[model samples]
Target: MKVVNENLPEEKPRHLLGIGEPEDIVEGVRLGCDTFDCVAPTRIGRTGTIYIHRNGKLEKTSLRKPEYQRDFSRLDEGCDCAVCEKYTKAYVCHLVRSGEILGGHLCSIHNLYTIVNFTNKLRDEILHS
Candidate 1:
């Protein structure tokens, strides 16, 4: 990235493709990347996994695991999206374990929402700093 940045105009935006982890995004931004995109959030959500922001970092959890069987909680306590607003962890866990399509759909919704919210917060912090 240092080498790449050296050859580009400072005022121009640099897009970092196929990178999406919060930590990676921060690193890429510091190294001159001004944009990023990836299918990981949706892909992982399809597999019954989702991201959550925790302790100032991104954390992931699998809904198919037995641990969620009795746990009743929203996908994200801080999220107010349709999925998080109406679904419980136990329900989503059942959907995933039962091979229901709505499981993936709900997961996708939360994953995308999480990323979008995180980015918005990031932008606000950057602007304020």
Candidate 2:
């Protein structure tokens, strides 16, 4: 698996396989991987949890719990997707707690869009090189 990534042409678009670590994401970009995705993000989100980086420290918030019952906030401040723009964390948490499938679907869709946009930005960066 590593051999394939090591052998990928720098000028041709290639995807890094099975990258789940934050450090690996940096390495993959350095290796010229224009696209990358993982099931971890959505898998975590669907469980009423969220990943956050605060002061360089990673934190996971469990939204399914009663603590976030009235806490309304965006899923991600940097995310430009419709879900992030309009929906609140509290609402999503409610959906998940109520077993509403839309919660998972919305989270998955926004997650995919974020990944797609990130990859496109990387592709642009590669093209400019």
Which one is best on TM-score? Answer: 1
User: What is the Å distance of residue 108 in model 1 from its true position?
Assistant: 1.1
Error of 2 at 115 (Å): 2.7
Q: Assess every candidate by TM-score.
A: 0.92, 0.68
Tell me how far the alpha carbon of residue 35 in candidate 1 is from the true structure, in angstroms, after superposition: 1.2
State the lDDT of candidate 2 residue by residue for 1-129, as single tens digits.
Answer: 456767867587776666644556657887656566677668866766655445644445676878667878787666778888889878988898998988877676666665566556666877798
Q: Would you give me the overall lDDT of model 2?
A: 0.69
Q: Considering only N, C-alpha and C atoms within 3 Å, which residue pairs clash in candidate 1?
A: none
Best by lDDT: 1
Evaluated against the true structure, the overall lDDT of model 1 is 0.86
Q: Give, for candidate 2, the lowest lDDT window spanning 10 residues.
A: 50-59
lDDT (tens digit, per residue) of candidate 1 on 60-98: 999999999998988877778899989999999999999
What's the C-alpha lDDT at position 48 in model 1? 93
